[model samples]
Target: MQDWAGVFIPLVLFILLSPGLLFQIPGKCRIIEFGNFHTSAISIIVHAILFFSLAAIFLVAIGVQMNLGP
Candidate 1:
């Protein structure tokens, strides 16, 4: 197996920071509107969920690949 620490450490840090970085960005489009606390929280939650799901997929794929290797 791969070293779990090495595999997961950066993912943990990135997962923590990226979603909040959205708040620092400012602009509006037809799809996204930046605004008050409630809306911002909802958007962040959605982003976190999306990020977590993608991360899980990647981690699972990596684990499978590692398991299949010598």
Candidate 2:
């Protein structure tokens, strides 16, 4: 019974927050290298915090409630 916001919002957020997926912004932290790919630990943590905050805000704004139990 959920609308588009239920699915679409999280999907977009996931893509945007996933490290080395869409964009790579290596801030002051050292970049970890494996072969040709590189990513920063600080950047990943920042993205995770940002994602959680945004997701919470969006959920509240969209009036989506969660049921924890059956």
Candidate 3:
């Protein structure tokens, strides 16, 4: 774990999780047309995308491989 030396993994996890906790999934999405994206599914999709993006960026910056192979 050379790349993870002296690292604080919990901080990265917190950053990745904060968006989901803080985002207000609108009851009715108004930014688009011909679509019903106000559902919980859509909100969850957006949250997942955001979380992954944050994780990707943070992990890359810290020089870690984005993998969870058992």
Candidate 4:
């Protein structure tokens, strides 16, 4: 349970935060251009912030502790 949470939670966050996998933020040029479909630099930055913020809120809501040492 605890071990699963530790691994699963961060893995989920990483997938969710990955560019173009979940979010399709638009802008001028593509962050990782693949023909026509692509994401922009500014949009990537903005979405990264948004995703991190949401992740923080979620972690807090789930009462996940962040400790440095034992």
Candidate 5:
């Protein structure tokens, strides 16, 4: 159960963040395609950093809790 909690914590955070939903936007817009999908230029860097940093933080918290044990 504790191990499951560790796994679910990050999963829950990711679901709440809904980062995958970003991909659902239509690709027709030049900014969407060029800014996010095509390259990691200045335009999309902030968003990319935010998503990964949040994900890493959540996962690390889960890992720490798991290591501490019940």
Candidate 6:
């Protein structure tokens, strides 16, 4: 139902972003030897943005749903 859309959007977004969040692990291991910190820094920023954007979108959706009532 429409209620489910509220839950599904964030779930789908999170699932899609999960791969990007994990993509730098091997690169991180290799980069450690070279003392290169940029890989991890970029990964952190990407993940933080992904997570916060999803959270903000979900919050806004929920707020609108609440304002509209059940």
TM-score of 5: 0.31
Tens-digit per-residue lDDT, 1-70, candidate 4:
1335445566787776666666555535543433344566776787688777766776756757545444
Cα lDDT of candidate 6 equals: 0.54
Model 1: lDDT of residue 1: 54
The lowest-lDDT stretch of 10 consecutive residues in candidate 3 is: 30-39
- Residue 32 in model 5: lDDT: 41
Candidates 1 and 5 compared: the better one by lDDT is 1
Give a tens-digit lDDT track for model 1, residues 1-70. 5445435644764654353343312223335433422334555566667666666666665542333235
| Best candidate (score: TM-score) | 2
TM-score of each: 0.42, 0.56, 0.42, 0.52, 0.31, 0.38
| TM-score, prediction 3 | 0.42
Alpha-carbon RMSD, each predicted model? 6.4, 6.9, 8.9, 6.5, 7.0, 8.2
lDDT string, candidate 3, 1-70, tens digits: 2444225554556554443344424334443223342346665666567666766666667555434344
Q: How many angstroms is residue 1 displaced in model 2 relative to the true structure, after the best TM-score fit?
A: 3.0
Model 1 regions lying over 4 Å from their true place? 1-17, 20-29, 32-39, 62-70
Q: List where candidate 2 sits over 4 angstroms from the true fold.
A: 21-37, 62-70
TM-score of 2: 0.56
Error of 4 at 18 (Å): 1.6
Between candidates 5 and 6, name the one with more favorable TM-score: 6
How does each model score on lDDT?
0.49, 0.65, 0.49, 0.61, 0.48, 0.54
Candidate 1 structure, TM-score to reference: 0.42
Give the better candidate number (1 or 5) by TM-score.
1
Clashes of 3: 0
Please state the error at residue 61 of candidate 2 in Å: 4.0
Cand. 5 Cα-lDDT: 0.48
